[model samples]
Target: MRNVVLGFLGTQLDMGKRRRWRPSISLCQTEGFHVDRFELLYDRKFSRLAHDVRREIERVSPDTEVLLVQMDLDDPWDLQEVYAKLFDFAKDYGFDEDRERYHIHLTTGTHVAQICWFLLSESRHIPAALIQTGPPRGDEEIGTFDLIDLDLGRYDALQQRFDQQTREYGDLLKGGIETRNPAYNALIDRIEQVASISDAPILLMGESGTGKSELAQRIYELKLQRRRVKGRLVQVNCATLRGGGAIATLFGQRRSHTGQPGTERSGLLREADGGVLFLDEIDELGMEEQALLLHALETGRYYPLGSDSEVTSRFQVIAGASRDLATLVAEDRFRLDLLSRLNLWTFRLPALRDRTEDLEANLRFELARAEKILGTRVGFNADAADAWLRFARAPDTPWPGNFRDFGGAILRLCTLAPRGRITRAQVDEEVETLRRRWRMAENDPDARLVGEVTDLTLDPFDVPQLAHVIRICRTAPTISEAGRRLFAASRETRTSRNDADRLRKYLARFDLTWASLHDDT
Candidate 1:
């Protein structure tokens, strides 16, 4: 079924204002939807305008889905009151079906696009998400903001490009726009090489926030630019693959069992047959499924989940895994043969810490992103930079979480930074808060057997020592196992014993003992 997005452009409030509605108009036209009408709602405030919008909704099409759109002023607008207005209007107009048919999109032009998700009760903010217009902004007559598309698929594509370009510029451009990192350049070079190839299963391995998916898409686009493929890049999260029968869900299930009468819809793999298939977290696939995938990759064939008939499908396979495949294979959790098959062309994306040269560049990239997102300029003060420099090089804590963690901390400080500059104290406070919260959470019974190790001083001297302790804790099955890892083997066993004794004393001093190991206890 084709979904229709209908938006009402001007309000009485915007009538006299230097309004740019042409972009919105052109966008609707280009989107190829049947526009019933575009009436100007002149009321400025929620109380007055909502009633008029409700009337328009009923008049337009009482039975169809109506998405009421509005401009976000960034100023304090009473959201509770705004929703009340929409609710009252929907109730009066009889638009409220069991499942909410009427939707509201609160957009702030080219700035931050605030969303009011249709929850049953109230609307809350979805953090770290923003919306902006596309390039060659002149295409939209209502300024670039008029071109903001609310379609999820289109939005995802646009935002993906924006993030990528922003990062690229952060690395390549002058004036601190791009971040320079050896690892990023290396990964980009690898992506270029993969893009040059047309038929090879590529394995992308990295920690969670290392931009694996982004790199995968870049490879696809590069391939497309090189005239190697013509189909859309179809992506599936293997972590979320399910076993529900009725084959139609994966490929479009035939509407009916009778072949002659059923619709022949395509499965995701078929949809992307000529393009690329990106399977995220492929390590999550069960052994039986892994065998199926291996067969498909080897023979260019995959049967629908419940179908007896086999289908011929060929697509460039790009898979990502945060876990170490060698470790998974050793543990018998993942297939070694399958890994060998996909590892034909492999690229290991390094974590944020491994590329310290790129930290400044990444920070600049993220800061630009924040400015674009927040509709305001934001920068790191000398103090904030020093604080980051302090921990940025920690061998024991070089961001196991990678870019995602970096983005989060940067964003938090960006938001909290007064007058667009993040202070050193704020950085220190945030870091301490993070550590404290982590320690508190570790006290939970469900917490795993891991240590939150950090160096007291940002100097590189203690990093490896701290990391040794972390490695010892992570590999240990029990206190005794940890003891073994810490103490096993050595001609000069005295040093090992001394270190173990010192570590045990340190743990005791911090009230962290073997019993604190949740996975064990």
Candidate 2:
């Protein structure tokens, strides 16, 4: 492979007395290094020096070809302009990495230019190693050169700083709460990286009250702080958008059809331009709206309702869904193309039950938030704290509503606490209240698993037992596991202890199957 060196012309150094060696010329004349081509970037004012350096390089290494790249920079010290010029040059340059090994000579350009080159090379925009050339010390005709392969992991200090910054980003996304869940921390870390680098649509999947909406807002704030986005974050709850006016609500209307005055609207998309558009409960969007949204996402332009001209709104999208969009697609309720577009950076936030270890941390966070809102500091006593922790981390806690439920529990505990100190009595009362609420929700046919899966009305006595059975089946890995849990006490009394068979028969009576319940879950 041929070696190609790219650098800027050092006008003052290369134009010095003929005896002194400059970066460009010295790079070409380095011992045991063969430069097949030297692509030298220079301002118009330094054209003469660029040519002189090219001549000297050609004289020292005749086999090397000289390509002068003229960059019109009014001020090389201007970082933005210099970087833009170099970026344009690299983008337009025909790079054949297979046949040519590229090197960026960092010794020739201005400090700003050198910084730009390093950034470009580090980002693989130029796909080259950095080379710094120096003048000869003594008795040597050629200068020395050092090749820097920009492997960031090799730099411990830099890697540590990067890791620290990443942790900070994650913390920012978590509202500065130091959660104890490893999976959750890792998820935040991945989200931090993606949010920093990409403007693609992000799909947040989780059950309701899993903090998807809060996390989406945090992501927008992160981008805003980093200057990745400029406009305000516009959030739309897709479930709330319904009826014939849904399109106009999202895409805006050109004018009032009823001849009413002052009905012009710019829409949420336009308001989100240059920022982030968060669509909470995106799976609830109508089919027509989904199609229009898919079109707007693919092309940053969309026509408003009753308008001939097209309007543009370039924005990053963060979509939150409580339901499985792929399942909706399979059911033909959601647009497959829209799901494809939004699924690029999908992240599923774990439910509160899945992250029980984070219960205490979230409890503290909620308490602090409550203090801010209520204007009074409130916390549980030692016994109450321990009781709350034990109940929260219990396997059967069943945090059906996740963080939303947890936050409500905290708020109520604070409100009921005497003199801002929640005692063991208050904790016991709150726990029982939570249990009663959960039990009621579970027994309510309209909200229970039995209601969701089957349309049949069952005996009042059978509903609660059947609902509990279905809930267990949904969470258990297999029919045998669920049956074992449900029939543990009774199995010893049975002559033939076939738990799975018994469970299957019970489910068959209700026209339900293990596979169907598991899938729905």
Best by lDDT: 2
**Model 2 Cα lDDT, one tens digit per residue, 436-494:** 65676675753455555553446767877888887677545457878999999999999
For candidate 1, the TM-score is: 0.49
Identify the runs in model 1 with alpha carbons over 4 angstroms from their true place.
Answer: 1-184, 243-252, 255-265, 306-308, 437-521
Worst 10 residues of 1 by lDDT: 124-133
TM-score of each: 0.49, 0.64
Candidate 2 wrong stretches, greater than 4 Å: 1-9, 13-154, 445-521
Clashes of each: 13, 0
**CA lDDT of each candidate?**
0.57, 0.84
Q: Provide the global lDDT of candidate 1 against the true structure.
A: 0.57
Number of clashing residue pairs, candidate 2: 0
For residues 1-521, write the lDDT of model 1, one tens digit per residue.
23333233334322323343332233233333333333222224553555544554455445433344453333434566444544454344433235332222233221111223233213312111122322224454433333233457986898999777655533331233344565666566556655565478888888776878777777777677667878889776664444432134334444344455545567676787888988877876667768777887888776764457788877888889888888999999899889999888878888787888777767778888888878899877886787776777666554645776677677777887898888888888878755654454356322211223221222333334544555455434334555656656642556445544555775664445543322110
